[model samples]
Target: MKYKTFQTIILISSIFLSIGGCVTSKPSAENNTNYTISPPVSNNKMVHVNGTKIVDGNGNHIKLKAVLLEGWLMWNGTLWGAGLTSETKITQRLEKMAGKEQTELFRTAIYDHFITEKDIEMIAEIGLNTVRVPFNHTILEDKNPLEDYSARGWKYLDNLMTWCERYNIYVVLDFHSLPGGQGAFVSDPEFINVWHSEEHQQRTVDIWKAIANRYKDRQIVAGYDLINEPDAPTGKNLVDLQKRIISEIRKVDKLHMIILEGGNFSSDFSMYDSPLDGNQVYGFHTYNFFTDETDVKNLEKLSELAKKQNVPLWNGEFGAHKLSWIEDQLELYENPKFPINGWTFWPWKRVSENSNRYRNLAKIIPGDDWKEVAKGISDLFGPSNKITPEFTKKAMDSFIEAVKAENIVYDTEVKDLLKKY
Candidate 1:
């Protein structure tokens, strides 16, 4: 499917949903529809790890230079200028302020505008060959998760894969948040309950099975990232859960590579003495405020681990730091001793009143009312209840408008930096 075709489908779906009621309205059994996914495009070949390197179907070694699509399917509050907060909390707050219908509309607006074909084109133009798509479990499943998947969620993935396929970019499906929260970080703010609940663990595994089944034959899908930056009680527990998920996914998907992140925000890997699976990639993330010394040590450790296990390594998430820090990390990744198979930058875009902290490829300019609105939502200056619904609507609408691809300001310096490697 082409980009214009996707737009037409979205327009028609929106119209149909509007006639029936709100797009996010709870569906009745009689009116329920499952989204039809287009057949996977075979422009790219399936990639697998071949002794510490990722080789494609034709046995060509490939290094995945990628960017993450954050704040799109998973609505992190920080991305929308609302401080560090979870998607669930943000949605609940939006509903409290704007009624369910209006809140759903706001979500629809963000989903439609956040990352379009134009954005994918820009990524390809920047010379990145892959995309890291992070999503919350709710994006694919409804309240009754195991029974059926959401049509809306399927549409989002289908559209993304179609766009990536068109641009020859591989997609890494990252399950950023699971049934219960996987970590205490803002990225997993539903609550850190998944680590303790067996039901949540099973749900998490089942979610991967479903995703793997859906994209089993899709060559453009580079891998199925089991969980993102998990924070388990013990490294053994983490590896056990990961191994189980891998076992289940292998039942449905044998071709796609399985990517695993260690516990403690993917910074620890002491539990594994050897690779658990043949085609697995061990992914690690780096986020430091002041120094690259720690990063240097960690990369060297991961290099030794990769060499010992004879598996590929990926810097699945990094960036959101000073430009100089990004350059330093890039150099570290490309060092022949470390031998990193690939690396994906943390975020492709972000909205910031202050860009002095961490630079992103695209800068989202939240409107004049944003600072107050952001404070209100995050309860910095005051509780969200203190803000009028009218004010909330105005500020949020403007922010949504600002998130459009056409409205974004790309940083050429960042683009040039990415193009260099």
Candidate 2:
């Protein structure tokens, strides 16, 4: 079934407990000094790798409970109510249907309102010290030869980094979608498979090198996520490509930590025979349908792998289940014996009313035919259909309004859960 279709009936009842408490304590200088020296200092300190732990500038072990900033730079049709297969297609279609000027206006509005300074401040208030910003590779370099790099794309990222700095939150830059597409999903929009194309691989490396050079000194940038959910059927191919990217990144900046994900949508790690490089963390994605036993076993295996390689393990993406499931996952992650270094929830926000599993903290009205339009280019899978220009305009207008209003429906329960960690 299509992802949209499956989302409707995937709900399972969950019993949630009201977990609440508050502590009032007087601060003593002696206690403050002892706590301050511990890992994860409250101050805005640069984060780096220290053996198997991610530590702050003060050498305190830091655990990043972060939220993934999705559907912003990297547009997901299911989340954004834009029926396009990829971000490039969305922009091109919008420009064609609404003219360049109008398209630019809509794009600007989306970027400005999607996750603003207020959102970052709220994330900080929730006790999340980091955010994973996912972006399409095209944002950096739209051209093939990598000659004309776009400064406009960098502006959005720069804005986010600035906000992160202000909120004392570390940012993890994720190259979510790559040129020529790394996987078969619509999000990975390209004619050829990236793993098979040497040109695409080189361009990917060049993009990371560029990013490293740009944000190497930014303390708010915690690390570089080489790629998001790479589907490498041939595990060796993905492993080799990641190593090359790491080598390229190291050439420019060695201060920030590098995050390397496993093959097959970040679920398999058998390909990793040894540590790829120093100051690197192994990333894996898990969505085990809230099965506690399975989730625990999966995490245990990954943690064992991390131990074997003497590297830290991070759940780069998770969530899309009941709040109870989220709570259970967090509990497993915080296990003392098989402790997970950190985790970033799958998404910070999205619009949906049927089920809460994959819904974001906020919901918006998608124009009438949103479901039909979201079916994607019909020629490939279903009947061909186009969203009328009038409909597009109305949708964009309403979305822009929602963006500006920024009246998000806060998930206080989830927020409280995160803050406790």
TM-score each candidate: 0.85, 0.81
- The lDDT of each candidate is 0.75, 0.69
Candidate 1, 227-291: lDDT as tens digits? 88876656866777787787778777777888888865687888887676778889898887555
Q: How many clashing pairs does model 2 include? A: 2
Give the least accurate 10-residue stretch of model 2, judged by summed lDDT.
Answer: 13-22
Candidate 1 runs further than 4 Å off:
1-45, 144-149, 186-192, 292-294, 380-386
- The runs of at least 3 residues in candidate 2 whose Cα sits more than 4 Å from the true structure, single-residue gaps closed, are 1-45, 82-85, 88-104, 142-149, 186-189, 289-294, 357-359, 365-387
Best by lDDT: 1
Candidate number achieving the greatest TM-score relative to the actual structure:
1
lDDT for predicted candidate 1 compared with the true structure: 0.75
